[model samples]
Target: MIDYKPVSTPMSPKPKLSLTSGTLFDDPSKYRMVLGSLQYLSFTRPDIAYAVNKMSQFMHRPTDMHWQDAKQILRYLARTLSHGIYLRPNAPLALHAYSDADWTGDSDDMVSTNAYLIYLGSAPVSWSSKKQRGVACSSTEAEYRAVANTTAELRWLTSLLTELGVRLPTSPVVYCDNVGATYLCANLVFHSRMKHIALDYHFIREQVQSGELRVEHVSTKD
Candidate 1:
């Protein structure tokens, strides 16, 4: 793929990858090797997190379509080798996280993809994109699950900051695009729709009530 023509993006706006859609790859070991390398690259290239995570789901039995997706990432990297994450030393210490989810985006399993970006002032410090553990009943449910996951990450970051003697002036703010999810977090009422979710994910509400985190609604376009 070294001399392949460069593409504009790492993934298509409408991807067709699925467990049953493509022919099985003949060499599983080679596919895993390349996938592993890309996974490491994702530590700094948050732009490719969704593509990398999508392809990784097929590591056990990669197909030609999977290899095609991997090559697209390489082509994207080749076209923009000079671009990478930059952190600013002068950025504020206040932690803010933006979280979103693609409801039932997976073609095969119908699982939602949860994503979050953690920023210190204007600079991003951590981010993640992963498929959810189970199927969500509604778009709101998917978004709520993403909030739960982001809240867990915020808890860890808060602990780490405390250990480093860094003081946060106020509760860490979490921004989500889904109004229903934000309302669910802010309200204590356990509706029938929310009973299916595990008790552990409810920690986000506890943190909100205890003043450890603040969940807010943001526009999806932002």
Candidate 2:
């Protein structure tokens, strides 16, 4: 792809890749090799992280469509070679995060995709984009699961920073786009819809009650 035309985006928003969408790729090894390199690239180029994660799901049995998507990522890289995360030494030391979910996004399994980006002051220190373990019954459930995942990561980061002698001035806040999920965090009344995910509910509620974490609602447009 050295001389390929550049693309503005890594993956096309229209295509929803599935496990069995296209014919088998002619060269499986090549597909895996290229995707493996892209996985490494995602560490610095978070713009391509979701695309890489989506393509990586098909590594075991790559199709022609998957190969084309991978090439598109390369094209995107060519267009934005200079883009990367910049860390500022004078950035604040507080921790805050944003969590989101695409409910029933997977074409094959109907599992939701949960992602979170945690920022330590100005620079992003931790982020994740992956499918949920189980199918969520509602959009609220999916969003709550994402918030739970983000809270767990924040707890770990808090412990690690504490060990490093770094102190945060305030409790970390998790910003979620779904208002219902945010309410679930602080509301003790358990709705019947959320009973299936009781474990996750209690786990996050414990942190909030102890003043270790805070969950807030943020509009998706923000």
Candidate 3:
């Protein structure tokens, strides 16, 4: 696993997300090489993981259009290379996670972008940005899918901590912005409303019921 630098007290300032999306690059091979570098850099810069991963999908036959997007990530990195996870001293260390989904975010496949942000105490340690497995019938289902994915990540991390002899202080807290999904998780109800969701998703409901992961509704901005 990559060890990302953690920040606690505010240093200079949080680096702003670079606004440049993409530009024009002529060499297809160089474009592929640059993409490789950015993907490795994502070990320290998780915020850009989604954007960089999206750009890498076009590498085999990268167009001038694809090259522009790769450069855009470089520009964003240029503006925020100094940033990483900020872990403060003497603060309470707790594991908390937040999940969200962009329903049908992709116009082509109509797949949702399932992502989560996880904080170890005041600093974030783990996060993921990935495409969901199937077409969700509703926004609630999409968000629930994201929560299930994030729950798996939490379970794996906690297991690693236990193997390393690190005692976890509390049950991991998982916050989702959608309330209806929260109900879906707790109610244990089966209905046409959720028929499209895969059967494996019940894993989240089980974890929630057994108290391995606590699901709570939080403000979307958090």
Candidate 4:
């Protein structure tokens, strides 16, 4: 839509994206092509990540509503053509990660969405927005899984930097908003209910004890 009016937001806050939200689009190929382009654009524009992840779920069988959302994202991109992420050359040489999850946010499935952002000093270096592989029994379980994903990324970054002969200013710290998940990572408590996630528990605990990473809680508002 060359002349389409620009929108302020990529997605509507009232109704979140769902696979069964609307009727099937007439031409799914066209929808796939547009969505593919948008996915490529998200490499630099993280603001549309959540919305893009939602739309990506319907790529196999996109509907008219999905197409509408894609158009809305286009409008948003149009409105902010000049906006871009700029990494500074003189930023500090430290690593930090922030992770968050939406518990069972999918309407069609009970799966959660896990998202994380990794920063080297002051600028973002890596980030992810993906649906969890399995259903979580509780919000804490979902949040904890997100932490594991972020921690894995942290380790990779650490090893890469070390190979380059780069020493970080401090140990990498991971921040999560869920108190229960944060405690699970930092504390040595082993409850019966946590047995299902024993592998994740051991993985993170090993990192904490070895001083490879640190997990802490942060206010959601932060």
What TM-score does prediction 2 earn? 0.95
TM agreement with the true structure for every prediction: 0.92, 0.95, 0.81, 0.94
Q: Model 1: runs farther than 4 Å from truth?
A: 190-192
RMSD of 1: 1.7
Residue 184 Cα positional deviation in candidate 2, in Å, after optimal superposition: 0.7
Candidate 1 structure quality by residue, lDDT tens digits, 1-222: 779898889887655788875798888788899889999999998888988998899898788878778788899988888878677888778999999999998978899999999987787778999999999999989999999999999889889999999998888999999998998997877445699888888888889889989999999888
> How would you encode candidate 2's per-residue C-alpha lDDT over 1-222 as one tens digit per residue?
889999999999777899998999999999999999988887777678788888999999999999999999999999999997888999889999999999998889999998989999988888888999989999999999999889999999999999999999999999999989998888888555578885745689889889989999999999
Model 1 worst lDDT window (10 residues): 184-193
Q: How many residue pairs clash in all the candidates, one count each? A: 0, 0, 8, 0
**Selected candidate, larger TM-score, 1 vs 3:** 1
Predictions: Cα RMSD each: 1.7, 1.3, 6.8, 1.5
Query: How would you encode candidate 3's per-residue C-alpha lDDT over 1-222 as one tens digit per residue?
Result: 024333332111223122232343468789788889887887777778777766666676676666655666666666665788777886575788989998876655777888898887788788888888777778898999999889899999888878988776778988999998887887866434787677888788788788777999998876
Instruction: Show model 2 residue runs off by greater than 4 Å.
Output: none
The lDDT leader among the candidates is: 2
Shift in Å, residue 49, candidate 4: 2.0
Candidate 3 ranges beyond 4 A from true positions: 1-26, 190-192
In terms of lDDT, the poorest run of 10 residues in model 2 is 192-201
Ranking by TM-score: 2, 4, 1, 3
What is the TM-score of candidate 3?
A: 0.81
